[model samples]
Target: MEIIEWWPKIDPTAKEWLVTHNGEAVAPDVLTKIVAAGGSLTSDAWWIGEEGPDGFYLSDEAIDWIEATANGEKA
Candidate 1:
């Protein structure tokens, strides 16, 4: 599913973290919330970054989606 579609379902803390740390690697706990909310990590249009020892760095598209969401804009 698209991040937009499942955004509202994600935990509030996760949303806040995404907004505050826009370009940073996503924490594993937050990523869990995303997956639970139906966000896709394997989708080409969704997550598109490397998984390293630190965390998942979101793709540009993913970052844009979060920014738009924070601004109350449609995806």
Candidate 2:
């Protein structure tokens, strides 16, 4: 899956959130968690992937975490 980091300051709603990353929809619980986090987040980057569509990104540390997870390294 591709990871997309959302710009928390500029985004405040689920539709806005989805449009920013070009996504269809996400669970309310997930969106709640994302909004609950403060701005300029340094971790908990959003993970994304689509069929023949877009790529994604995450925080530097989050990227490391993703790599480790994909590589099967325990946290």
Name the best candidate (by TM-score): 1
Candidate 2, position 74, lDDT = 74
Q: What is the alpha-carbon RMSD of candidate 1 to the true structure? A: 1.8
How many steric overlaps are in each model, in order? Answer: 0, 1
Worst 10 residues of 1 by lDDT: 44-53
Query: In model 1, which runs have C-alpha deviations exceeding 4 angstroms?
Result: none
Residue-wise C-alpha lDDT for candidate 1, range 1-75, written one tens digit per residue: 877677789878988998999989898898899889887788875556777777888888889888987998987
Per residue, candidate 2 scores C-alpha lDDT tens digits across 12-59 of 564344444433334444445554544233443344222233323334
